[model samples]
Target: MEWDLKVIDELPDYMKMAFLILYNFTNEMVFNDEMKRGDVPTSIQCYMHDTGISEDEAREHIKHLISESWKEMNNENGDHNSSFSKEFVHVCKNLGRASQFIYQYGDGHASQNTLSKDRIFKIIINPFPYKL
Candidate 1:
């Protein structure tokens, strides 16, 4: 699609952090995008630098980000643009739901316990055993 990532640079560091949460989730679902350049520590430092917030404030901001991201991903609750297909909307919601679990434990992904390849396979490839 020749997408331009430069657009993401326009966002404030905290927002960029929030967007990365969704982006990382979506990228896991739909791979082959541009590789991430910066490390998590660098991103977090930028966020704190731009916001001038302490760790407690950062924690609250993270909570708010997670909530807002979930609402934004939801079709009925979010920006329900009619041009998007039902399946596409479902994928968006799925991304949010999956990330909600992943972020439940503080930065749980780095452990590689929750965000494992096997789990991705389960989410993408495994079909529910339903019968008519």
Candidate 2:
């Protein structure tokens, strides 16, 4: 789905800043993953370019958004509605765990020079030489 910029523009400045931070952070993650360069400076530059905000402002807002997201995720863990099955909840937890492992040291999943590459190789390329 595409984002409606019109709706986003209607938000208050603080809310707009938060949304911009989140959007730029997501873009940074994707770009870094694809480029195999966990370059925070590039991401910050992108945020500044897109939001017309100072680097300090972008950094502060991005950090705030990240902190808020973690708090929300922590609160939601194991507290889903009845519509979500146990298996689905388990999968969600596993996804979060995998994301944490992969990004624990920058864009490790994308950069071959990082420890993530070795971990990924062990997990996907050189699995245990035994039948499950």
Best by lDDT: 2
Instruction: Please report the TM-score between candidate 2 and the true structure.
Output: 0.51
Q: Give a tens-digit lDDT track for model 1, residues 22-131.
A: 65443332221122433334323445678998755654565566566555444243334556566655565565567646444323333344545455555557745567
- Number of residue pairs clashing in candidate 2, backbone atoms closer than 3 angstroms, sequence gap of 3 or more or interchain: 0
- Judge candidate 2 against the unseen true structure and give its global Cα lDDT, from 0 to 1: 0.56
Global lDDT of each candidate: 0.48, 0.56
lDDT of 1: 0.48
Deviation from native of the Cα of residue 59 in model 1, angstroms: 2.3
True-vs-predicted CA distance for residue 84, candidate 2, Å: 2.2
Which 10-residue window in model 2 sums to the lowest lDDT?
12-21
